[model samples]
Target: MTEISDWRKRIERYRFQGSECVKCGARYYPSRIKCIKCGSEEMRDVELPRRGRVVSYTVIYNPPKKFSKYAPYAVALIELVDGTRVLGQLTDVDFDKIRVGMEVEATFRKLYEYGEDGHIVYGTKFRPVVS
Candidate 1:
């Protein structure tokens, strides 16, 4: 009954991190085995920072049938300090105050839940850095 996504382990580790393809420099959030750009099978694992800024975002009024309960949430493409842009949910603040360039930090949070498997999926999300 954890609150983090299992896939988060792919990108959220302090060590054994992800990286862009050296051959093509294609950004892989979870460190792919091959360059998604050039299809090269060589990739270098690199540590990513926990800080970034909002590159773009939107408020989801209509969610999937299963995710309808969590509708009216803000989703954003956060551009990390290393220049890698990743899409994630933005939390912990008023929706109206969210801005295009607002500073944010990585924070894992509850995304959704389902089934009788008694599992609570958690994933890495972002929240406004409180001043």
Candidate 2:
């Protein structure tokens, strides 16, 4: 990503900032300017819940060029404690042990490097919650 775009998204990348509609109490990740539920411009920034459960998942054997180095990684549809469903890559656990309803939590990690300067992009990924 370009430096300008990365700067603009730093908060979202690092903090898991989302939006909540003041009118209807709807919430979204990747914050929206307008509420899709109530069409209200009144919104507030909110931090998403870090803990969640795996709803479903898949192992990607062939990924895009940017992510090919991490091929065969597991990506999961996670339902957060607040009932927000998010898709994120699962890490730091045995692939065979992954299953529906497995507890997980968000962990910040490197996404990839881009641009001629090799700017490292960081973001959230999910790992099994330690007992």
Model 1 error, position 97 (Å): 0.5
Backbone-clash count (model 2) = 0
- Give the whole-model CA lDDT for all candidates, comma-separated: 0.77, 0.89
Each prediction's RMSD to truth = 3.9, 1.3
* Clashing residue pairs in candidate 1 (N, C-alpha, C atoms within 3 angstroms): 3-122, 4-122, 5-122, 5-123
lDDT of 2: 0.89
For all predicted structures, in order, the TM-scores are 0.77, 0.92
Q: Roughly what TM-score does model 2 have, to 2 decimal places?
A: 0.92
Instruction: Give per-residue CA lDDT, model 1, range 1-131, as digits (tens).
Output: 23354545734433425676878776767667787679888778776677899999999998987579888899999998878877888988789999999999988676677666745566677899888
Compose the digit string of candidate 2's lDDT tens values, residues 1-131: 47788789888878877888999988888789999988999999989999999999999898988787778899999999998888888999889999999999999998778657778888889999999
